[model samples]
Structures are given as structure tokens and as C-alpha cells.
Target: MAATAPSQSAPLAALSSTATELDVRDMVEALGAALTDAGIDGDLRGSITLAVSEALNNVTEHGYAGRAPGEVHMVVDLLADRVLVTLSDSGHGMPGGALPPGLLPDSSGARADLPEGGFGWFLIHKLCLDLSHTRHAGRNTLRMTFPRYLAPEKS
Candidate 1:
């Protein structure tokens, strides 16, 4: 389905789909396009894409593990000074219903012994200015925001 149209005072984009790798990729791509259309690019755009992609991947892989894929809803808003993104799902909540501390995994071990995973949340935290998660009534909601980003002024 097409993404929702943006309004000056409303969300820049909104989309919903089953939580799957393909769908998550599509959502991320759509979001990137929306950000580009809104004159957002470079590092800020990269961070938003990475964080949102990781969150959606987690929902598909962990939240819906052993069950049918669940629905994931995403809304993005580009304010004058920041970008706000909210993702929600009716799948399993985070362990203990709390956000992960997002500490970087230990990398002092041998190359082969290094972690092959566990960096998603860390990267998300590092890129976002703020992050939050909540679970209530069997739904999980994740909210993240990034600092100002706008296309460079044309000469």
C-alpha cells in the first residue's frame, strides 16, 4: 500500500504492514524517500534509516518468533529541529518490558570470538538523541528522535 500523505503540521509519513524482513526493508526505503523529499539527507538520514530498520527487524525476528508475523505501524514526523519516529506492534514485548541498556558488546576477545550480533540497540542509541519504549495492553511502542537534519543550502 501507498504511504500516507504528509501535512505541514502532521506526520511526514505513516505506514503499516506485516513484520517481515521484506516488509521492513520496504518500509525503511519508503521512509528514506520521504526524508529525502523533505530535504533531509546525509548522516541524519543514515541514522534514521538504520535505527528504524533495526527496530523493525527486531519486531519481525524476536517479537514474532514462533508465531505468525504481526502488524507493525510506523509514523515519522519532521519538526523544525528534529525528526520523530514511532513504531508499534501487537507482538511480544521486550524482555521485562523495559528498554535495553544499549551497551556496546565486549570486543576484546579474538576476532572469531567477537559477537556476531547484539549491536542493533547500541547503534540505535548512539544515533538517536532520544529513545523510549513502552508495552501496554499487549502492544509494544518504540519512539526515537534525532537532532536537526536538513539538506545543505544550494550555492
Candidate 2:
């Protein structure tokens, strides 16, 4: 799949906060509200929230290791048929070529060890329309997109 460049347009809501679990929830709520106000449905909103949470958690846990104070930048864009959220952080980048796994393995009759970590990426991929990650100049950028879908609430 072709990757698009980072958006230059102003986000509906841009939040900069210290990488913390509480801050992640606040950012998700703020972004979800902005998208909903822009006419996105609740289902999409939930998906977007999950994707954003996963991205932010990755930055807080792996990127910064929750040690030093680092900035987590979140931007939400309302598009014609989708909502896009881009999260950027200035922290240690993932090891070169260490992309997250695409999907979770089937659990039926398969008992896999849970110690190996990669489930966040799997969940992000499953929840959002599309996700792209990039690291440049020690900054990690994650873009998550949610397609506009009419939820039961709208019907």
C-alpha cells in the first residue's frame, strides 16, 4: 500500500501533553469528540479511540520508556470519508525494520506464549481503517485513519 505524507492542514484538535496513561485517555476523548462533531459516527469514533490509545501507549511505554519527559503530539483531521489522526513523539525510535506484526494469531487450539509483545499493533490494524508508522530524526510518527461508517445510533 502506498503511504501518504504527513498532513499539513491544521487538525480539528491538536493536543500536546506529557506521555502518561491518563493523558492518553484525555487525548482520545478530545479527538473522538472533534471527529463526532465533524459528523463521524460512534463506531468510527470508538475505533479511532482505540487506535489512538495504542499509538500513544507505544510511545509512552516503548518510545520514551516513561522515564524522561517527552512531548506527545496528537492531531485529528476530518476528511471527506474518513478521520485521520497523526501522533508524533520525540523519543527513541524502534529498532530499524522492527515493524509491528500485522494481525493477531488465531487462538483456536493454539496456545501461544503471551510474553512476546506485539498485540498493540495487531489491535490497531484491526480497529482502524489504516495505520502507518515512520521514524525520522529520532521522532516516531504514527498515522491512523478511520473510515466513516454509519453506526446503529445514526440509523
Candidate 3:
């Protein structure tokens, strides 16, 4: 089958942080600028922003919560029709180094018992074309790929 998106051959782009909320914000801004600099279209920009934000939030809140200072590293690879984001944190890994199987966020359920708005993973799964996670040697890594044309062009 023919590919829907253009090809990519760009070099990798990277950012490092301490996994704090402020640092995550800085990284997000920097990455957004990087995407625009690479000629990313607007709609895809929004998706990438949301996905990256949620991912970073998870890293700070879950992976590194209450831990000693450590680094959260992110690398971006921009291709003609896609972007790949790899985020790594030197914090406690998930049990057995595996991401919990992604679930449909319970946000839509009418069940009163389900807590509201734990929607980061759900948004990440829906917005990104691909998502994967791993942990080894005490570092957790999340890699997400997003298609360039997910956003419609501005009229």
C-alpha cells in the first residue's frame, strides 16, 4: 500500500529536564517551536503538544514523584509526514518495566464509581499514531509517533 505521509530523513532533536512541571512546560514550548521550525503543519502541532504534555505530566507525577533529582530526556525526529517523540526519565520504573495496557479512559462512562478525568493515557493513545513504553536499568522511556496530516488546513 502507498504511504499517506511524506518521508523523513531529519537528524534527531533532543531536550533534557528534571521532570518538574516548569521544566515540562519549557520543554513543551521548545518542542513546539522546533516543530514549527521544521515546517510542521498547525493541526498536527496541537496533537503533538497535547500528547507531549500528557506524557511529561505522567513522568513527573507518576514516574518521578517524591524521588531524588533526576533527568527526563526527550528526543524528536521530524520526518516529512510524521514526528517521533521519545521521552526518557531516570526515575523508578513501572512494576516489571511494562506500561499498563492502555484502556479506554473511563471519562465517558456514566458509572458513578469511576473517577473522573484520568485522561492522559487515553488522549495519548487517541492522538498519536503509535505509542510504546519501556524501562530498563531504572529508566522509563515512552515513544510516541504522530502523523503530520492529522490536522486539517486552515481555510
Cα lDDT tens digits for candidate 1, 16-78: 999999989999999999988988888778878988898899999999999999899999987
Which TM-score value belongs to model 3?
0.79
Instruction: Write candidate 2's Cα lDDT for 96-135 as tens digits.
Output: 7465765675455535644355678777777776667788
Task: Give the runs in model 1 whose Cα sits over 4 Å from its true position.
Answer: 1-8, 150-155
TM-score between model 1 and native:
0.88
lDDT of 2 at 141: 85
> How do all the candidates rank in terms of TM-score, highest first?
1, 3, 2
Task: Give the Å error, residue 31, model 2.
Answer: 1.5
Could you tell which candidate, 1 or 3, scores higher by lDDT? 1
User: What TM-score would each prediction reach against the true structure?
Assistant: 0.88, 0.78, 0.79
Better of 1 and 3 by TM-score: 1
Q: Which candidate leads the pack in lDDT?
A: 1
- Give Cα-based local distance difference scores for all models: 0.86, 0.74, 0.79
Ranking by lDDT: 1, 3, 2
lDDT tens digits by residue: candidate 3, 7-45: 344445688988889989999999888888877847788
Best-matching candidate per TM-score = 1
